[model samples]
Target chain A: MRDRTRRLVFLALLVAMATALHVVEGMLPLPLPIPGAKLGLANIITLLAIYLYGFRDGLTVALMRVVLGSLISGMFLSPGFMLGLSGAACCTLVMALLLKYTNCFSMIGVSLAGAVGHNLGQLLAACLLLQSGAIIYYLPVLLIAGLPTGFITGFLLNSLLVHDRKSGILRDLVRT
Target chain B: MTRADKILLAGLLLISLLSVAVLYGRFSIFPAKAEPVQAVITAQGKLVRKIYLTEGVNSSLVIQGRVGPATVEVDGTRIRMMGAPCTGQVCVKEGWIGRPGQTIVCMPGEILIRIEGAAPVDAVTR
Candidate 1:
């Protein structure tokens, strides 16, 4: 019972931070000239959850963040919310599969795969919503932009994991 | 980054370059024609309204977007998004588009404004 409560608290903390990052990311204008392209900073926490607690918890965190963030932003049940849902679903699934199935993939490989999956998923949703096949042409630009953004998020998560290992704060609080 | 990661990144870059090359070829083969006559607004891929731009007349138009109403301005032959309900404001930032084939898309609001239909050639031009 005690351990379960601790786990719930930890998950809540992660969800809160992830939601904040999602909202904050939406507010900032991306330096990249491409419309709708972002660094996806909230994904770092999702990756952490996957690495620590596992894919199920990671999925939970990603979905909860999207729902709460969109609701807070007054975008609930909108096209943007749909895009977020598809992106997060694809991203988390790809990262989890890469980590679990592949030996050669470290965090970087997983992150890159997640980024690609995210763009493809969101574009698919956008195409469906707008009923425009022409949007496929934008895929190349999004894929190119994903390279750097994915690497940065992955790199940050890796460094954080290293720090967490030494500090053991999270380790003591949550049972994996 | 692993050796496979480097290889994967390189491969993705190559694919993107190839796609861009193909897209460029397609674009060059069929250039975007100019001299649009009407601004067509669509929400969630469904036609909402079409406003023909009259000569020397200015007007404001609105369409129901996902979040709220998206406002657009039409002036003579030019059209631009005046205010947007979407957070990105990408549609508003697209500025004025006076030619056919230009579009302002607000993905968040599920709104797409496209300038289409070429201006008719008068007797002298014909």
Candidate 2:
């Protein structure tokens, strides 16, 4: 019972942090020359949840962050919100599946997969919504841009995991 | 990073470079086809109209958006979004655009207008 409560509180904390990162990342325009490409700083929290909690909790945290972040940004139900939701959904699912089922990749591999899936999902949304082939070039640009950002996300998550390796939660909950 | 991570990263980079080369090759297929500059407009994911932004041209168009109609005007070689039914009317505030690659997008209206060059934009611009 206590373990479950801990998990719940931790999940809530992850969602809160992820939401804050999402909104902040949206505001701070990184020097990435590509228009829509971003740092994806919130993804670190998603990865953390996946590693510590599990796939379901990880997905919940990710989706909740996007929904809350979009609401906070006042872009509710807008195309930007849709794009963000799609990206978050796809990225989280890909990361969870990679870590849970495959187990072939380290945190970095899963992070890279999540980043690539995120961009691809957003592109799919934009293509279907706008119906313009003009944005096709963004596909390649976003894909290339994913590499550096994914590496950063993966690197950060790894460091955080190492830092927390000794900590309370990892020992409190017996991970499946 | 693990060995598998390196492979994935390298593979993604390869695919990105390949797609860029492929797209550039496809766009340059005509090799300087001197077509006139035009602004393509789409609403509800369908092509609404194409306006050639030639000098001395004056026209007004109304495209239906998700909420209501959006007014667009073309004067000389520039096009501007006049007003939109949506609350923000952010598109209306975009003023005017005449350069290639410039775009005006209204998410609520599901409207997209982009200025295109005769050939695709050069590497630096895009």
Candidate 3:
């Protein structure tokens, strides 16, 4: 149907935007002392997709972003690729579940959970790859960092959602 | 925020505080309790060698790592990576590590240099 096609086109655009964010973030030099810690700016698009569409569509966008982003960055099939995949998977799943089950959590809470889940997923992947639990030491730092980063992204998404709702952009997308 | 959000935030705050407390406790309280005696080298998850770090001793080692060659040097109380084939050379840039629990890892070379018997808690945890 036309509705399905329109939704597909919208999702593709989201994927492209998410990939751009991911690639751009990868280029910046973060001052964090931890090795793998990042702001995860691209997750904003994932959260938006979930809020707009649903879990399946959000997950599709997240996975597509990770894959295509890594390919474009020339890190496909590398350790970084695996880490990104695991983190994005956990982030999307946790956010989707939270959104589905609880109305109590605002987008901020959901974004916080997603960020924490992403860090935990990356930690798990690092431990498995290195065969060392020493990586767990980074957990506290990552968690502490996640709080602020998640809050910023969540705040941005909340404002953006409010504006879109007022403009009827979200409703139009949902209708088509 | 709702009650649920408040609870989640409180829980995360507690965890972060606990982690920071544990890290501080490990570094400040237990540091003087143990002394590091040796440096252990591992490549590809296998033990490559163990070098004793004694005063007035100097040693150097060249390891055939996964990526290429890596060189390590130990001078008296300090140990460091002299050279490595990895692109970043971060291990070499780590300079000298004389403390127990300190580690210099060359990921591309699959080389790890860890100071053993130095601290009661692992450095990563610290």
Q: Choose the strongest candidate by TM-score.
A: 3
Q: How large is the C-alpha RMSD of every model relative to the true structure? A: 14.5, 12.1, 10.9
When candidate 2 is compared with the true two-chain complex, its DockQ is: 0.36
Docking class of 2: acceptable
Candidate with more favorable, higher DockQ: 2 or 3: 2
Best by DockQ: 2
DockQ of each: 0.25, 0.36, 0.26
CAPRI-style grade of the A/B interface in model 1: acceptable
DockQ of 3: 0.26
True contacts kept of 3: 0.47
Off by over 4 Å in 3: B1-3, B27-126
As for lDDT, the candidate ahead, 2 or 3, is 3
For candidate 3, give the lDDT of residue B42: 95
Tens digits of per-residue lDDT for model 1, A34-89:
76578988999898888778889999999999999999999999887998899899
TM-score of model 1 (first chain only):
0.93
Clashing pairs in 1: none
What does candidate 2's lDDT look like per residue over B16-100, in tens digits?
8988887767665324346688999999899999999999999898999888999999998999999898888889899999888
Indicate the residue-level lDDT of A155 in model 2. 89
